[model samples]
Target: MTLKHTISIITFLFALPLIAQEPDPSEAFWNRLQSHCGNAYEGNLALPEEDESFGGKKLVMHIKSCSDSEIKIPFFVGDDKSRTWIFTKNNGILTLKHDHRHEDGSEDNINFYGGTASNTGKANIQFFPADVATQKMIPGAATNVWWVTLDDKTFTYNLRRLGTDRVFKVVMDITKPISTPEDPWGWVD
Candidate 1:
């Protein structure tokens, strides 16, 4: 081959990786969340009027377990340790699921209801609309939408039920991570 053609080929090969590179917000968010593994933070109800179960309680979220595909965060409300938030990434799509357990480690009747993000979303936020499983589990929540936002100072979990007046929000202080709390109900360790 001519020198000019060889140089052109080399240049194109060198630029191939860069040209193929695309920013992935889901991966960024997942890495940011994984960074908090083994830490716990405190939060308060952003919409106290909407959630009585979280009112007058000390709310804590512990990034207790993490893996390549999933992360399990235990959410403690005062002495109640029955809730866990599970985040999973599959084929570039992110999903959020709620896992509830009784004190004896038994799964709650209402559990594993959540949604998957439409795409990579943004580096700091992701919106999850109720999935088929969630809709099947709770017909009334078929229109539920959940979103989580993360930034330098805070991480927030929010929910809104379309066609209803239900909303819940919790904002945790990422700047002041506290002592990691106990495992949620049903946690083996």
Candidate 2:
């Protein structure tokens, strides 16, 4: 074969590895969420009989803060601003926790209960089952499972209580992000 053709083949082979290597699913999921940082979206309860507190109330989710390893999203139910969903990444694994606060900025007794992803989920989805802390904090929640899914048009947060019929889901439209909402309780700026 000609020298030029031989050189081309070698160069192509050298680039093959880089091209074939796919991005880590956790990292890709983080990036997808970070893309919506500083924006807010409105949604409604999408499953199993909404509670009275959340029913008839405006629901909003703000991707308020994002960093390389952590993200804080405040979920607003009407004027109650005491809930924030926190996502953290470490060692190729992702964890999801709920931060609940009082109006005075103090944490609630039943706060920070969540779970870690058991594996590197797909680029658009991750599942978190009840962790030790969650089980201890809320015994009834020991069988809970939560998952988040993101796609080109929508982002959904879901929950299911295994051994029971309880379920909750909220879907946000990524195509149209609204203005940022007021700061969540205990969060300044």
Instruction: Compare the candidates by TM-score and give the number of the best one.
Output: 2
Task: Quantify all predictions' global Cα lDDT against the true fold.
Answer: 0.92, 0.92
Number of colliding residue pairs in each model: 0, 0
Off by over 4 Å in 1: 1-22
User: Residue-wise lDDT of candidate 1 within 1-189, one digit each (tens)?
Assistant: 999999999999999999668558898899999999998999998885656689878989999999999999999999999999999999878999999999999999999999999989998999999999999999999999999999889999999999888889999998998987777889975
- For residue 184, give model 1's deviation from the true position in Å: 0.9
Model 2, poorest ten-residue lDDT window? 47-56
Q: Look at candidate 1 and give me any clashing residue pairs.
A: none
By TM-score, how accurate is candidate 2? 0.89
Q: What is the lDDT of residue 164 in candidate 2?
A: 94
